[model samples]
Target: MEKQLIISVGREFGSGGHVIAEDLAGRFNLPLYDYNLLEHIAEEKDVAHEGLKKYDEKPKSKLFSRTVRGHSNSIQEHVAQMQFDYLRQMANEGKSFVVVGRCAEYILKGNPGLVTIFILGDKDCKVKRVMEKYGLSEREAQQMCKKEDWERKYYHNYFCPGQWGDSRNYDLSVNSSRLGLEKTADMLERFIRTKMQL
Candidate 1:
């Protein structure tokens, strides 16, 4: 059987990342896993729904012994690995889905029929968008963007071992600030169809 196409998106804060993912799913009639990945993991692993949020897009910060024999991973590490494996297994079972964040691109890298995309925009555009969307002042929006970007960077670097939002890691990268969400989604639909020869 042919492998299904999986588009995993990595994005910066206030980049319309979730919106784009939802739009893509709508355009292509594919299932999307965004915040729902957390719900699924929470149920399958017997982890509390709220408990899983602590690990969502967040990295572990504890120190562990580097050379200890029979070393075990931290709770967060173990759960993350489980979640990663679950996503892979689900994808393999013929779910053509759009996955948002959570280092999903890295988790599915080099897998057959996988398309990794990173969505980004200028800092000013991101700040403005966040401000308009959340009814926050410019300064507040900028601060929020800065803090979220830091968290995402730390999470990606600690888990995936690379610079987040680097275009090289993705099959295609798009700037939603210029094209807007709808057009960005349209462009992605065309891009994926052409790439996958659909």
Candidate 2:
């Protein structure tokens, strides 16, 4: 590969998006910044780390949010800006990496090496994956899947310019229900290689 490769993956909850990101990162020998983006923002501060975890993927307030220090960003807004700044810095410096979620596809738009992917699964597959992974009852898993997808949609809609799962926003969108996790990752790899001429 002559150029940097940045793969931004967005997945429905329980769609094994994170696992697929991990697999791609390992295969391509790139760093993956997933949930650890919180740690990057918190900067090893235990209290802030826990606090940010609690606010994970939450949207900013439309009404009560205010700007301080010449910007009217809520805490969530601040954290998101910081995360996006890091992603921008990385892309600008020609670093190759795989980043999961936090509207990265929108954040790093227009980079020549950028390859955005959204992974979604059928409702039954997603619910079953959540149940087995989290040791939850079927009803609990179903509720979790619904809540997570809703939160992700709201977060993206609130902060980003485009719909969260819209295929037009990404270079590729794959349904994990069809090929499953491993095969889906492989399929995405093929797309990435051909798309980027890797």
Candidate 3:
């Protein structure tokens, strides 16, 4: 039997990383996990989805008061564990899948079928994409990109030992802006197939 393949994509905000993943998933007929993963966690834990959204791709609040620190930390730990458990469960099913962000690459490390990818783009391209997608001004888009990138970095650094987006941590790191989203997707799909020796 062919081994299952799991593609974990870590992407800069506004980098079309999700789009690339979606395309790859479609090509491979694999389920794509992104916000849907959070939704599943929220439902399983009976927590408000909105509350979880605040913690996604973000570090624990450094400004929380001591009184709430314990509660906040507990909640964060629970959520992280839940997500990790779900990812592990999915991997064990031996089904192919494409999971975007939420530290999936780190969580699934050491799995022979795993292919970790990090997607980034030129700052100007990222800003443009964000502005168009969010209907924001250029300046607003630029600020949002920086803030989101920092949050992702902080979250990954906090939860995982390796620096996020370091090529050493990923099997492949591609700049979507250089190749465009469609071409990037094609390139990644081919790369994954090659890596898996399909």
Q: Using TM-score as the measure, which candidate wins?
A: 2
Could you tally the backbone clashes for each prediction? Answer: 0, 3, 0
Which tens-of-lDDT digit does each residue in 1-198 have in candidate 2? 468999999999999899999999998999899878888767743446766675667787768788668786577777777788888988999999999998999999989999999998899999999999999999999999999999899989888889999999998889999998999999999999999998
Better of 1 and 3 by TM-score: 3
lDDT per residue for candidate 1 within 63-181, as digits (tens), equals: 75132475555656665676788788886776778888878888877777788889998888899889999999999999999988888888788778667888887888889988888
**10 residues in a row with least lDDT, candidate 1:** 64-73
* TM-score to native of every candidate shown: 0.88, 0.91, 0.90
| Candidate 3: 10-residue stretch with minimal lDDT | 65-74
Error of 3 at 31 (Å): 0.8
- Relative to the true structure, candidate 3 reaches a TM of 0.90
- Cα displacement (Å) at residue 43, model 1: 2.1
Per-residue lDDT of candidate 3, residues 54-148 (tens digit): 55566766665233544545455556667788999888888678999879899999889999999999999999999999999999999999999
Which residue pairs does candidate 1 place in steric collision?
A: none
Q: Which pairs clash inside model 2? A: 66-72, 67-71, 67-72
By lDDT rank, best first, the candidates go: 2, 3, 1
**Prediction 3 global C-alpha lDDT:** 0.86
Name the runs in model 2 displaced over 4 angstroms. Answer: 44-48, 62-64, 67-70
